[model samples]
Target chain A: MNELHIPTMAQMAAEGKAPEILFWVGCAGSFDERAQKITRSICKILQHVGLSYAVLGTEESCTGDPAKRAGNEFLFQMQALTNIEVLNAYAVKKIVTGCPHCFNTLKNEYPQLGGNYEVIHHTELIQQLIDEGKLKTEDNESFKGKRITYHDACYLGRGNNVYEAPRNALQVLDAELVEMKRCRSNGLCCGAGGAQMFKEAEPGKKEINIERIEDAIEAKAQIVASACPFCMTMLRDGVKIKEKEQEIQVLDIAEITARANGL
Target chain B: MIAQLVFLIILAAAVFLFSKNTGKIRRNILLGKDADRSDQPALRWKTMAKVALGQSKMGKRPVAAIMHLFIYVGFVIINIEVLEITIDGLFGSHRVFSRPLGSLYGLLIGGFEILALLVLVSCVVFLSRRNLLKLKRFQGPEMKEWPRSDANYILFIEILLMTAFLTMNAADYKLQALHFGHYIKAGSFPVSALIAPLLPSNASSLVMIERGCWWFHIIGILAFLNYLPYSKHFHILLAFPNTYYSKLSPKGQFSNMASVTNEVKAMVDPSFVPAATEPGRFGAKDATDLTWKNLMDAYTCTECGRCTSVCPANNTGKLLSPRKIMMDTRDRITEIGNNLDKQGKDFQDNKTLLDDYISREELWACTTCNACTEACPVNIDPLNIITEMRRFIVMEESQAPPSLNNMFSNVENNGAPWKYSNADRMNWAESD
Candidate 1:
């Protein structure tokens, strides 16, 4: 592991200070190996822009999205209430997360349980940063006209309708943004939602992730860009299944954006 | 006078049967738990107008939509003639409305004849589409014996009723031409006029044919009215109210469980303790536990298979079929109603909607994609029922799948879905 001095919200609070936003390190971002890279890329971008943000560190827990979606309401409530209590104690007002699931639960579901916060997905935050001219992209030809296709994560795209932010963030890279046939509201799920990531899929002709990957391939995208870690995992697995892992790269919007900015 | 008295008795019997069946259906729907969807009268009315009356969502598939609209409009407008039939049957009058309305009655009857002809054509096309064309959505496992037969039965009844109507008008026309008893020039029947010449010319035979056709037409309409309560065709009556009470919130919004929320709130708040009631089951395990809207949705389903056709899980070869969900719910409610009828209101059967009707595998197969809800013309929310059932299995029985069990434990102990302690949560932030 590379040394990265990430501040904690507790440290900031103890110092009688507050950052502009709280970076919610969702479970996947916190512990999953591949997802950790995306988390680091987001951190790199935040550091490069000098945007003040702090993690909840050990204070962060699962948003209980998986538990709730899996029908474990009691578990979901327990986890959610614990997090809500902490968030309320810190008087946290704004949250930015790399995972669409966390983004959805924190923004939409949490408010119902009195954990109201201005929650934003990392793509949206990245787009905002680019829009404000705080983050500048390198004018390099490395990915200037590369054919990139964006997969819409269900929780982000259909669940919350944040279709444009990821695209806008991708557009900042000056890459050709190709759309699969089923894009936006009509987009198919990568199949790892509603706690599907944890369980085996019921019998089917084909895995949904493979079907979605086929769409990405059909679009002839050189790079498959995603905004959610679960989508990144599913799409990468799909690319591997096609045995084109060497030819096609599956990357997060943060990774591509960080690379584009030479962060 | 004897004929008039007989007609009155038949009419009363039909009305009583129709009302009794409708009342039973209404009571079964009310057996579901109360949910206050009565807010926003204006929005509800607008939804009813757009979805039920305007058939806006049906427009997603234009061919079916146009055909459906024709039948729907015809069904509503043609029923006006029933008023004339009812009055005539009771008072032994002929051309009663024609005498009062004059030329307007001629135009009205002509318009009805044209609409009736259109309805007949639409019904035939729909029948052929279901039977001959064999649309994939219409022939799935969910549409087995009774559903298929029920569809065919409605179409057959519609054809017979329309034929009787045209034949009645044709025979009436022939009677007038032959100067039969009480037969006078009254209303126009442009479509039936072509048939008048083909009928028997004898005055007494023409009177018998006319009276026979009239009686069949009126009696068929009454029988159709009663049969609707037992058929998916009940959508013809319930669609309006079902659409009116549809969930007006954003499609993505899942209603939070209020009881669970209150309990969680009490835990979070130091000053509060949720009052103890006998700990209620967290979600629906039986038909009665579901909200009344869910039962109303079941009754209002047209079984058009639009929802099943678009369902991701069903299309992907999973066991989840939204149409089947609605049908099973309706079947369970009907079963409960029958049990109550036999055992007098306090009847308890060991059967439950969860295991007996809807299987756990079926509920688990749903992706919560909302495709079914969006595709449904009548706005049925199959996802809500699936989620509720899944909740019952998880919260009450602790019977979630093994993977879900792992996730629940992780969330409970580690505050996340992964098997890692919170102390290690920030390790990724420090990793290169």
Candidate 2:
């Protein structure tokens, strides 16, 4: 808390100071221990790049992604409309999210509910920052030759067709970017989507995340880079299951980019 | 004269049965909920052209695409010969277009003969792939005895039909060489020429053989037309419209329920009381609760199991196969349609798509990953059906899995899915 004085949208509005982008730290980013690291990494990048951004902090609620996906539309819409009213009160224009679920709900679903705003996943923003020469990654020698594979979050890749953005962001890393056999639109899920993370997996011979981890293992990737917070949780759990946590590390794309850039 | 009359009667009966079945299918599909897919005609047409007409998505598997193209192109192109056969059968005329078209008739028949041979080979390859090779996508619990046999039956029918076509051409070529009555030298038969010498050495027997083959080919085609409605092979006809009405929006966006929206609005504004309309069921519990497009998607499924093969639940040995979801939907709808035919519209069968066809366990297993939807060649959305049924389970029956109930409660009480207080949300920011 020393030098990092992150302002909430409430404080920014009260001070009559407008930020360029609203950083949507989704539920996982807000509460999950591992996902909070991704949230911090994204915040570090924004600070390093000198982007004026504000978070909702305590004002933020779950984007209702889990509720909506679980078929509780009433609860989802109630949460969504509350967030929408608060966002509209600030007249926020551009938003960026650390979770694909949040990114998808804000970008695609919120518009019809009268909460239209320019929403982007953090990977897309990071790629844009690199392309614009605002963020330099020439210092990414930490991952110079590490064989890193990216696990496509279903909400990001197939859900919204953002396959290239995350991959392009990885280009900034000097690490070797390997691909799972089922990559891009054909990428396998980590078995945590559609509220499956909140419930016990139904009876199955093998859990889906283990199957996904097996794919990553087959690719011989030393590091599996993730983009979404939910995916980070799933992939980490997968690594733990196979007891390969010491050998194969899972890091979010933002974390990788932040580390590579010396942020 | 009597021969022409008999041909007309057979053709009429085939056409009547075909139309009747097709009409019934249309009616059954329309029995579902209404949804407006008529927006963006230009884009819809383009998508249909690219996916259905061009078969662009089939290129995902190069081997299957080329093999399918052989049959698709052959099926479309060989119909020109069917046209000629129809005219000849009706008027008792031989090679009716020969004089008008001149040498082009020879060129056309030559191409048809070559295509027929390719179709024969392609069907054999397809048959072996299904039976001998047994690709995993073709095997599943949903692909029961009838589904497996339906695929085989279509291939066998295609093989026999193509053979009959070539044999008819061979016998006709031999008769033409002999200058037999009504067998003229009008068409080329490159592939069938090899079999011409093997045909009956006598002219009269060649006539009988030629006529027999002609009857078989035409009859087989008519029967196949009538069989399309009952088989997964219906994809050949329904894929066009199904692709045209594909979900144009992004996959992650589920349609917000208007009923829920009204309730929430009323809670906030108080003055925004919605009209007192008869409330529809919260989610789909029965086949009729699905949208017309969903019902059509069921009929359009080829049971290729592409969706199921890519399904995470199915891959992990879960009971939830997207292919099974679709098959069960189709089966339930067909059953309901039959019940309607017998017992009238007001009659109730007391059966439902939820418990009877698709178990709750299968619905709960889905992660809603969209792999199934992306993998479907015809764009059938099993996710939509899964979600629709989930809505019924959650809202109508309140039968959600116990873990999800806790999640819903946590989100309702706190601001997040977990039980953490909202005050702790910025703790990570402060620590960093």
Candidate 3:
């Protein structure tokens, strides 16, 4: 077993040391059993690349994405202001988020609340790591020739114009990358946006996640690659509901890159 | 002299009525909440050019774009002849520019004839799309009897207008060749020349067909101008202004609630006191609660259903049709505007854009995926209005779905949407 160290921002601050990047392990990444794997994968990649990064740990809170999207602006600003105070106290300058929701909120919505930071989605960081040539899975053939289709997370894709980074991260692997019928700017939501993750879809014939997963099935993708935590949850449930659990697998980009690189 | 006087009265009445209706539309649109879309003039201009004038977004569907261009370009260019027609009508003259421009007049009329033919063919194709073939985008819950008939009615009017223009030119061409009185050879007729052989050879009969079509064509144009305020075809004019004022931010970034921010600041900081502002409505319940841009978006909707067709919720049998949202908004405002006209400006109607027209179920069905916004060729944003209504539901009415209420409470209490304690946030790191 490999031993690894994860530092909290408080620990770094107490040690009078500053990490280069703050890894925003969003609420789903922290609590969801499946998303925890993605959180670890991102940490492993940061460690392997010898980049200095720290987590906010207990001091961190939800970025108020679900609250905001659910139209509880009061609750949203409350959570946002709390998180901003924490981030500003640490004088955090840069961040990489494991989820698109956190990435979008920290990057776009935070500035108006005075929580300005250079934020990137984990897939974007992975793309950059690949470009810098510090991260490699050149010899890893686990995903070679597998029909891997990438799901564009709404927050990462049309929301922030990040259609390329996730695909580019997948490109470094030796896999057959296919596209669902709706991809990029035309990508379908996984029924989790606007706080739908916590609610039953309003009287619809079929769930949105089921509809999105069918697109993956139609594309003949064995492994559906995703970048956002909420997307991963919805897609995993979708595959389970379709009884395609045996035939199809849902994995986040970080998990894929981490596994392929033996991290 | 009597004919000219009648024409002058008809033109004045059409212009006056059109202005009055459009002025009411402007007032209704202005009744919406203010929004700041005027900061970036250059960017807005470029967007208007690309989305409206250039029709860049329409390029997604090549067949529709090409056909639409025929009508759009032909309509703009052929209207040059409307000016000539007006001058001729007022002065009681035939081919008013013929003697002054000479050969240029012939070239212009030839081009107008060619354009009129294309517009005719295009309207036929557009009509077929609605009635014959029945493209799925054109049919939906919002597309009721009137809207369906209204679409065909516009196309039929266009066809009739083009037919009159060409047939009138055809009869005039025959009279010119026969050297009839005041029908001197002037402009060329490339398309109408072909129809000339089909006309009756009798000079008096030719004069009647020519004169009748002349009156019909001009009157039809005027009627169509007045109809612009009532029909979805008003997009031809509103699309320009709508695109210019569209939300330019990234689709994911919803506008932060400045009002909420002030209240939150007062709560967080003991020293800070919020300004004594009028208690802002949480979100939009009525059309007037929405921003002017959102109201204009309602008017600018072409009823194309591109947004609804691409909507994931709509695609999967959900009640959330973004096109319906826009239409309902337009209908609501128009209803309010009418009531205001009848019962004074302060009259309050119990109806609202939210539940009265758009249901709560339809509102919740939206994932805020922005598929509708992306799909709109004219840059209409159905999502902004969706979020605004959602804000009204959650913040003002406290009527978010039970599931969302639980999530909100969890977020408020535990610092996350789920019921996990903040103390355990770093548990994932314990694996190694």
**Which candidate leads the pack in DockQ?**
2
Candidate 3 structure quality by residue, lDDT tens digits, A10-35: 99999999999999999999999999
Candidate 3's TM-score? 0.98
Worst 10 residues of 1 chain A by lDDT: A1-10
The digit string of per-residue lDDT tens for model 3 on B1-432 reads 998999999999999999999998999899898788888999999999988999988887799999999999999999999999999999999989999999999999999999999999999999898888999999998897888888999999999999999999999999999999999999999999998999999999999999999999999999999999998999999999999987888889989988999989989997897877556698999998898889899999889998998898898898989999999999999999999999997888888898899999998888888889888999999998999999999999999999999999999999989999988888898974
Per-residue lDDT for B122-160 in model 1, tens only? 899999999999999899998989999999999989989
How accurate locally is residue B366 in candidate 3, as Cα lDDT from 0 to 100? Answer: 86
Could you report the DockQ of all the candidates, in the order they appear? Answer: 0.55, 0.86, 0.82
- In the order shown, the chain A TM-scores of the predictions are 0.97, 0.98, 0.98
Off by over 4 Å in 2: B275-278
The pairs that clash in candidate 1 are A2-B432, A62-B415
Under CAPRI classification, how is model 1 graded?
medium
Give the higher-TM-score candidate: 2 or 3.
2
Every model's TM-score on chain B: 0.95, 0.98, 0.98
What C-alpha lDDT values do all the predictions have? 0.86, 0.91, 0.92
At residue A68, give the lDDT of candidate 3.
Answer: 89
Better of 1 and 2 by DockQ: 2
